[model samples]
Target: MKDEIVVITGANSGIGKAAAIKFAAEGYTVIMACRNLELSRETQKEIIAVSNNDQVKLMELDTASFASIRTFCSAFKSQYDKLDILIHNAAYMNHGEKYRLSPDNIELTFATNVFGPYLITTLLLDDLKKSKNPRILHACSNIIKHFFDPKRKIDFDQLQGQKKDSKRHSVYKNYCASKMALLMVTFKMADVYQNDGVKVNALQINGAKMSKATLRKVKPHWRIIARIQNLYFPSPSVMAQHYFDICTSDKFETITGKLIDHKQKMMQQPPSHNPNVITQIKQITGSKVYPAYAANPEIQEKLWELCNSLTNKNMVTPSSEQHA
Candidate 1:
């Protein structure tokens, strides 16, 4: 019997590493795809020692770079015949950094948090399809609520870094926008790949304890706030267990296009109110409103096309490649 193969991006630390350990312990072939080989090498040792299963492998993958993504896919294809599970766990966020771009000149946050997962899933679709019950889990953030608020709309210019805002927490703003875009993409992908027997779902990450490295990058005042929040946040191990349960349980085998929270409950978008009419609703109910994009398909398609346009011939979509 062949062991199921699982690939987790950004598996060097935090939840990714913890998930790797959990999967390895289950006797699966866990591939730790990450940007930092040095950190990953250390993590590989820990995963092996802790799991007592030596099938953990390390490969370089910089989700922020399109070229790196392509290389990683090619390398993976040469060695592995199938991918049973893919966890898009790698994310890039900065507390107070100025605007940045990937090597492909896309907005860094979108490139990593949204575009990277889209490209990886597209590239690895065939490998995933080879498995009888393949699955793709996107590690999504609940911070998307901020971007999906009634006051906000999808900013096409900002998504590709063509426009910059003078907002104080522009980086955090980018992070939220990217997360919202990711959910849109995840639902779109669930529809696109439905016929191929690929199950795509987004995991809505609640507050999780922050790593020291992540904490160090925060501004001093915010670091204090983060510490206070950390006291209430679930540990990474608890979150990793959730990842394991979702992957291994048959209950999720057919569940697609859903946003699942840490408590294993489905998250539905709040009933959308017109931004203009939000005040009316509030006045009528005297309760706060959670207005969102409704996971609008038209907007999702436009964003999908924009992301596809940014890629070259090698990164064509599955449907397009089919016609070609």
Candidate 2:
């Protein structure tokens, strides 16, 4: 991991912060992409103290806004020559409250969990290509099944948060929607870039400690609700070790376009990984991507266009070339 130039979004705390420290321990030059300056500084100190890796630096990144992502990417390119690994670990889920709006006027949940990481990856594709066995690990969740609907569409317009007049909608459902969009997006990207050596895959990492991000957003009085909500919080650092293993795992150098769960690399089954779903996602995400089991160029194109429109980012395209 020492030689790896790794960048992790929302790296100041929780799973992301833990992953940064672990990577630093393994000798990787880690860029902690975060939104808060003071907090990021504090986290850097803590990480440096624990790992003694001064190579760790904070890069301001707020994935919800394209402007923020552009700044982070440009600043990163100015100093670093290449990116060996990119972990799309930072995610957004505002529980115990109604959905919020991002700076870009999009739903906060969609912006943070889906749009932010998607744009950053597209902007950093060239840098990732510079690595020998470049890997892209997307932080999905086991909670995705929580959002599964037999009537769901890969290109469903409402999945991007146009909900209204529905009191039945819960944070749990919305969070899963965000991750499902991401999962589909990962496949789109993997299809385009897997052959380029920049392998992009998603993982269901459960049992991580509560993220400070989680702390920051929760309403003051909602702590009780939050605790009850998080009945089974896992160790953030331990789960981050799984992230570290994936980012640093030599065994996965050639592995892409697969969903990894708790160290088990398994094939995504029907309906979820169906060609129709991939098609919808590609059209929505603006990437001609496909699943390993069923690669279809036509469907990939349709999904990409839809994705591009929803996010309002020009990075609606991807190339699956496994390289470096």
Q: TM-score winner among the candidates? A: 1
Query: What value of lDDT does candidate 1 attain over all alpha carbons?
Result: 0.81
lDDT, candidate 1, 186-256, per-residue tens? 88989999999998888878768889987887899789999999999988888888888787789898999
In the range 214-233, model 2's lDDT, one tens digit per residue, is 76677777766666656777
Tell me the lDDT of candidate 2.
0.72
Candidate 1 at 275: error in angstroms?
A: 12
| Structural similarity to truth (TM-score) of each candidate | 0.89, 0.80
Q: After superposition, how far is residue 23 of candidate 2 from its true place, in Å?
A: 0.3
Q: What are the root-mean-square deviations of the candidates from the true structure over C-alphas?
A: 5.0, 7.7
Model 2 misplaced regions, further than 4 Å: 152-155, 158-170, 211-232, 270-303, 310-324
Error of 2 at 132 (Å): 0.8
